[model samples]
Target chain A: MQKRISIFIFLLVHIASINAQEAKMASIKEGSFVPLYGASSKKPTVVKSFFLDVYPVTNEDFLNFIKKNPSYSKSKIKGIFADKSYLAYWKNNFDFGSANPKSPVTSVSWFAAKKYCECQGKRLPTMEEWEYAAMADEKRIDARTKTEFNTYILSWYEKSKTYENTIGSTFKNYWGVYDLHGLVWEWTSDFNSIFLSGESRKDKNNDKNLFCGSASVNATDLMDYAAFMRYAFRGSLKANYSTRNLGFRCASTTKY
Target chain B: MKKITLAILIILSMQSCKDNTQNKNVTKEKPISDLSIYNLPSQWTNQDGKNIELKSLKGNVLVMVMIYTSCKAACPRLVADMRSIESKLKPETKKNIKLILVSIDPETDTPQRLKSFAIENKMNQEPWIFLRSTEENTREFAAVLAVNYKKITPIDFSHSNIISVFNPEGELIYQQEGLGVNNDETVNKINQEAEKIR
Candidate 1:
């Protein structure tokens, strides 16, 4: 009878261990805002109502994800799906070493992050959605004009390796989301959809050769240096490329 | 035993479904390389409204470029560049190759629309293929190719113009960026890859 009881407990524990982590989501109301960079004719782009994870996907959540989808594990991921440094901080295929499990998972490729979101029946937030939600501070939804909000984001930029910190350690924003700043940079669904001027300048004498209609996409707010940095950083990345300070969270269109 | 049977049933069903859709000569199955575009499982529709997997195009060297049909600026030049590349390759080399134009604006560039565009551009030929897929797949493909594109207005998009070359094995071997740039190197790469096919 004792053995039977122990077996039942064992089954329960095993099932619990394998279950995927379901992060809490914040409902963002649809709104319009002119972004610092990307797809602009100096007009505000409308972001429809959607749901976003309160925090970036944590190391613990990712660990659970890989366990369920073994093909996406550190050693097993295909070269086309990720670069050499995918999950480079991890000790092995399964172990994350001494890193806190609650810390936001960094060094993850866009493909891996996209797959994680898909498995959860979600997706990586669009560039516009991410920028819109990220603009919020504790008090105001659109805090891009605020000096303190800019300082806080820029300060986090100067601080090296804040990805080591646990999720939700930063202050919650107006939209009830955390770690939009003061944490690792994130992967968005449309990260590849940015055609910035830096690359256009590199196009070198042949303006229209590199991009179609490059003249139209000028930044509406050039003073928002912090947001500009984000756009520039996103432009530099390829899908398979992974970095130590980059991670991602999933978003869904449905509020549920 | 029942589980194994069920899994086999699923696999069989998937295979049969695939076979019905793709009606080309995929003679022998080869192990897809990890770096191959065939590794992507996204389904695509051709100008003829036929469904295809990227793997089905294996054993033929591919020269691919992305363009939206409605674009007034770069696409025409991009198409001209593709045609020039095709023209440069020997007729024998062209037999072993497919020049693919994938649409970035899938909603605007339907199979019927793609067909009209193909006819309009005089690319409605044997070697020229026009393809479109779901928005997600199109985005994923663009990500793989490192082609940055965003919708500016309801009708306009800002997009990078790059022509990609893939070997017969579906691995991207080379890329020639920019519109109306020299295609000499791009042509050479295609001819070299196509040589190994037959």
Candidate 2:
């Protein structure tokens, strides 16, 4: 009887654990996705998924990063890090005594932005992922009518404001991601890489060599025709360059 | 036996859930497309110093080229290429399409300088505009359009010599590379792209 009771208790415990595990998995599986525009179609031909940031990284968040990683601090930085644009606004505007630490950190270089995400055990979203998230919802499509999106995007270039309050202070995108297209231009991990040429949808075999130059003749030929021009454009930007409009967000793979 | 069965079922359910979660996190990837070069950043000043934004050019098709007044090598050829294309357009098509030359050298390419550059190129026409912006704004704008440029020295610059075409709605429709190419072929391509928007 004692043995039987022990076995029964064990079974009950295992069942509860299993149920909990199942619930966790379900939540992760329900990840959000945004779609990309096709050549001939107005609607997205492909869907790209990403994380939903409740808010942009605040000044406090960046300060914490600096505290943890001394290398990124003003003193330890070198070479491209020495550019005036790197910390011009942030250093001048930030008031340690009065500034809101929770505000999103601005005036950071693309390299620094990447390092910040790495410290947090997260990664920046790729440009494709960023665009997909921005245009996720059908309902939001009407809002982003050519006129409105153009106007909104252009306005940022015209006006010159030093600091914004925080990330969520502005409008949110379709996937509930805040300040994607507006508040600041977030940095992406693959923003500067030359993407593998070729149609993303048709190439199902996932050829790694296509990314490099040494792929098979067939693959190279396929890539030359299928690759988009935007990839080439991204490759043009030098890493040392920094601008006021640039900022970043973090993403982590869902641990199962 | 009943307890054993229950335990096995729960474990299997848990494993299935984990797999589903992993699947959900995996985002769908897609190929990027060739975006129009004209869909660049906004609020650029024309050669005449008028504030021009992409939206403001909504009614007419636009042909865009990048130049700096200080450039001695490519700017002349680029302007000549644009003129050659303009000459080939039909009277009605010419009336509909606007030619724009944006200055990558914002610091030195002032309104007066841009105007003189246009005059020297004999591009003093209805649609031609020489544009300039602040250093910060221009760099951001250049990045958006993927127009690579660097100060080879203080006075001279090296930049990608590409011309962009925009539709009436300000979407980047097409791009032509380099200054000198098959002029007739280029003109035909431009006219064909312009007609789509018209």
Candidate 3:
């Protein structure tokens, strides 16, 4: 009888642990915004979620990938492969002897970034996910304030340095993700499609190719004035164009 | 014997519990198509100085790239690269594709400026239009595309370089970054993805 009672208690405890595990697994939703940077009072645009890295695949990561899969080496890549700008600075200028293996990679094309993410059982985040993460902390205001929001954002650019380092070296956002705002511009998995005239944001169902969107604000405010400048920057790029600042990180579905 | 049987039963139940937890983990991945972009405010304009409503470009693939006419270095190269992809397509396939260039430089890229810029670039392709929205709408669009840009100076802007592509049904198909250098790969990927729609 005592053994039977002990068995019943053991079964209950095991079931409870399983229930807890299931709950943890079920939490990641499609628009799950993990807050990286906290909100600033002036520019209330809260960045709730973002990629953990600033740049794309680097030479170090790609070299290891090539070592594992020799078919993807430079010789094997056909027409319009990595250009001189892809790894120009890193290979020729920087000394990476002390770089970390798991740091965000640099000097890779969009194809190479996608391929590297795939090989690692991961994929690039969608544009929607990326923007959602960026503006997670962004807020729209009727008027602009003389505050640290714009100052801090502008300061990020001034302090911007080379691509030789990994993410998380600077201050991290609320979600524990690193290097979203200041590092290098990461790549997403969307195509370079623009929105048409008479397009309704609600009916975005028709134009599936449109990957870019932004927050709403009045044009009168000085701070809100150049919002369109942000959108056009991404639309102007071709796929293979890699610059000193362009880099990417990978995201997995949690299951993989 | 009875004691042994009870212990075995407890162990079996625990094993089954572990399997259930694993199953829950497997279901967390949602399909990409299930996601949608957030809506924009009313009263927007296209790059060609045309009023924009959401209903006009139904049942067409919308490819959007953001740029300013004043951009000397990356912007022109991006347009040329996109043109290369557009030129390669069959006319009929091209008809189904809507190429849009949204200007981030709203201060300078007025409706007239956008219109002239489109003509200068030979962007007369059907359903291809350039647009300039209010600074608010532009930001909304940027947030949706995940593209980031900030003005370093009056004429110069520091921004993320990327292109966004959507399918005929308005589902985000793929995005390619790196403009002039990645043109061939970008075009190939877009063509391959567009072919899979039907």
Show how many residue pairs clash in every candidate, following the order shown. 0, 6, 92
> Candidate 3 on A1-256: residue-level lDDT in tens?
7866887787778556434322111111334332121111123332233333333455565665665444345444322334445544443323334555445556566655666666655566655455554442234211124355445545665564545566555444433445655666677665233332223233232222222221211222345322233334455554556675667766555553
Off by over 4 Å in 1: A1-20, A200-207, B1-28
Ten residues in a row with the worst lDDT in model 1 chain A?
A198-207
DockQ of 1: 0.44
Model 2 lDDT, residue A64, Cα? 57
Q: What is the TM-score of each candidate against the true structure?
A: 0.90, 0.40, 0.39
Q: Please report how far candidate 2 places residue B12 from its true position, in Å.
A: 55
Error of 2 at B150 (Å): 0.7
lDDT of each: 0.86, 0.55, 0.53
The stretch of ten residues in a row with the least summed lDDT in candidate 3 chain A is A209-218
Ranking by DockQ: 1, 3, 2
lDDT string for model 3 (B30-146, tens) is 421222331222356876567975435545667787788897756777777677768776554566677778888899989888878877877765757887777645654664565
Error of 3 at B119 (Å): 33
Residues A45-126 of candidate 1 have per-residue lDDT tens digits of 8899999999999888898778767777778887888999999989998899999899999999998899888767688999
Query: Which parts of model 3 have CA positions greater than 4 angstroms off?
Result: A1-59, A90-103, A136-149, A194-230, B1-198
What is the C-alpha DockQ of each candidate? Answer: 0.44, 0.01, 0.03
Question: Per-model TM-score of chain A alone?
Answer: 0.90, 0.59, 0.57
Distance (Å) between predicted and true CA of A24, model 3? Answer: 16
Residue-level lDDT of model 2, residues B36-137, one tens digit each, is: 222233467877788876545665788887778876777777777788888898775676788988887888998888888778778776867777887645
